[model samples]
Target chain A: MAQEERRILVAVDEGEESLHALSWCLENLVLQNSKDTLILLYVKPPRVVYSTFDGTGYLFSSDITAAMERYGQEVADVVLEKAKKLCNNIEKVINMVENGDPRDVICEMVQKLGADVLVMGSHGYGLIKRAFLGSVSNHCAQNAKCPVLIVKKPKPANGNQ
Target chain B: MAQEERRILVAVDEGEESLHALSWCLENLVLQNSKDTLILLYVKPPRVVYSTFDGTGYLFSSDITAAMERYGQEVADVVLEKAKKLCNNIEKVINMVENGDPRDVICEMVQKLGADVLVMGSHGYGLIKRAFLGSVSNHCAQNAKCPVLIVKKPKPANGNQ
Candidate 1:
């Protein structure tokens, strides 16, 4: 008989915060003897650079393109690194990068992978962009088929709990 | 005039799902625009339901007793129901249900109340209960604050945009 594994799909971004959220989800949802999937999501927002691609705006250029790729790779690396250290069973995890809106990708991936839940940081690299787009996290929560765990960034260390 | 306020607080309970989640928060968070205090909280596990007689348990019993008393009064229709309804602005939101555990309380409340930035839901409820006490929500997203919404229930009937 297959084990009743809880599929906790963690969504990591470009900072320590998303890792922290994934850590929480791992601890809370993925119990001992349960299967867990920690998916690292490094989403590169759609960039419309006025490049010479068909003489229209396509996201490919010298610095902007390189910088975007660099940032995307960095995000994936950092998030996965921190997450690996934070997770319990490393064998049940996977990490990768995607290009598009975080919310849409998150929802799509959740459906595609049959993710039971989504774990994410509340505030991430694209706060301004999210606000402009009416909140990426909000869109994900409203649209995603699975449950989402929203983690708040910890305050600068002080007496705050 | 109201400082362009934007926040939504939701009290979550896992069993409820949907309208009890982000939808509830979104519905009520937008209730007062800038003045809204979006608080998404899952009340911690109710301290062991000690009877109303001994020690620290007395304090909690008093609160429950008060709630029960009010419930009774409303049932009898002796007191003006509208008075209680009109006096508390917090009670106006839909899809919020009070649960025995603090975790459920915070999440459902926040979802129903619709706060802008969630004040406390994950750690406060989970950490407070501890492993022995069995607080589940504690393991949720730990960095979700602003634009962070909660959902104790499932999605609404009309579907989210």
Candidate 2:
């Protein structure tokens, strides 16, 4: 039987929760008997804000920013490594690391790349410090043009998936 | 049996969806084996943009705003009528409509009042909309002192209890 082809985009901060979110997405697709292309997108916001001192415009350098971008890429690598187990023909996986605010970038990239849905981890480092839903996921849910699947942080790992 | 009481604060707006949201919240509590007190909160933003020539502090006179305050009470009546069926040992229901930024007022009220959780339906209209969970629920989920339970707009009602 032919299954529905679903394109799933996940914002990977490359943490345990993100991996769990990816794991959940794959399970959901399996449950739906759907085939999906999974894009693991990561974003790096600049370390410093830039401003124009004169008409020359904002003085911003990409050298350190590029290194930070690579830092995010490295983190994406961590996510990709874990994703390898589920990277089968049923699920085509890709990685992306862009520089910008995570929230805006997720919605923009999903639209630009034509992803059908965004799957995100609800609680993250953002919540640990701030005590709320992760801002990146929250923003995507509010603004994404596509349906968003927010996976709650899994309860204390019970040695089970 | 003396059951633990459930307190829910519903953000009240004169919107089609807000009324539906209240209905869902009450139905949700009816399923659980406990009583609840429903609090209707309305937040009014500054009516006029202040000017230096306006010659007034940021906070204005409540007396001067009495008419607007009365409108707040009117919204309370709407909530009471809606809650009429859902009240059992539901205790007393009350309304509070204050003027300020919708987000700030919602959060401050949650902080000031002891509420177990907040429930909102996913859609808004008028100057303040529940659209995208409205700015209030969005901000409160991030900044409020309590847990928030949001009923997604267009959720599959599929005979869900």
Candidate 3:
């Protein structure tokens, strides 16, 4: 039987965890399949709307906001560049950058692009911290339309191992 | 760099959803790798303790209890048999049957066997239903040491598609 080409969407970020996931996917899933498309997605945080006055009663300047946006773009570029190097052997690679919350953007893109699988990296945050700050991977796993693969970074080798 | 042989543990059950996940794994992950080990795990519900006298004032016979155990084994056999057929092309396949809660069992096995990837099927229950009856896949995805892949069965294609 002929195999259908698959679109594997991988969410990348500035963190090492996401980069690790991309490498793992490339090694395990992408290296063997020349037909599959590897989509590297980086979601920038939504642009902040600034009022005239800041919380500290300081004047909010447009320059500050613009600088922040530029920084976000640079970070996205660095992440996508690192991910691309890992996919050097892959034939079809698509780089995408969307500005929004990572969780929502990932879920939406998976459905819109008809992705066969969504690969993400676990932050490995503690329970308390995860509750205070929402986990993007966990949220995407619950809400995404396609299969979700959460790749965990293995712990450093202990003497026992 | 040569890739390391990976142990892929797939959690199977009597439900069609799990069988579908096994099929997906075979097509996507197992076919290309001859050295990778495919572990097919089927977790049976823990045996119930039967009292001599029932709450309804009926006596529970040993025969009835034995028959229930037999039925459970039969179901596990049927599921394993069907899964085996799907895995006929694969060279290394290991069948495992354990009795316990599936969520706990799967998480424990992944760690004990040092599985590289754990594949499971999403029941795809709605939010409310998922809340009432806890989702096994969700629990394992959060707790398992290895990467967890939750394969969701694709919805029936509509005429427009």
Candidate 2 segments exceeding 4 Å error:
A1-3, A30-33, A49-70, A124-134, A157-161, B1-161
Deviating ranges (above 4 Å) for candidate 1: A1-3, A49-64, A125-134, A157-161, B1-161
- Pitting candidate 1 against candidate 3, the one with the higher DockQ is 3
Best-matching candidate per TM-score: 3
Worst 10-residue lDDT window for candidate 3 chain A reads: A124-133
Better model by TM-score: candidate 1 vs candidate 2: 1
List iRMS (one decimal) for every candidate. 14.7, 11.3, 2.9
lDDT of 1 at B130: 41
| Reference contacts reproduced by model 1 | 0.19
lDDT string for model 2 (B1-161, tens) is 11356567777666555565566555433224345567877655555522222455555567656765565566656755664544443556776767766777777887688765565544432333333234555566556554454444433553323
**Across residues A1-161, which tens digit of lDDT does each residue of candidate 2 receive?**
11356567877665566666666556433223335567877665434421211236555576855765566567557756666655554446787877766777888998899876677666532333213223676677677765555555534554534
Question: Native contacts retained per candidate?
Answer: 0.19, 0.00, 0.46
What's the TM for model 1? 0.50
Cα shift from native, residue A18, model 2 (Å): 1.6
Q: Name the better of 1 and 3 by TM-score.
A: 3
- Model 3 CA lDDT for position B152: 75
**lDDT agreement of model 2 with the native:** 0.57
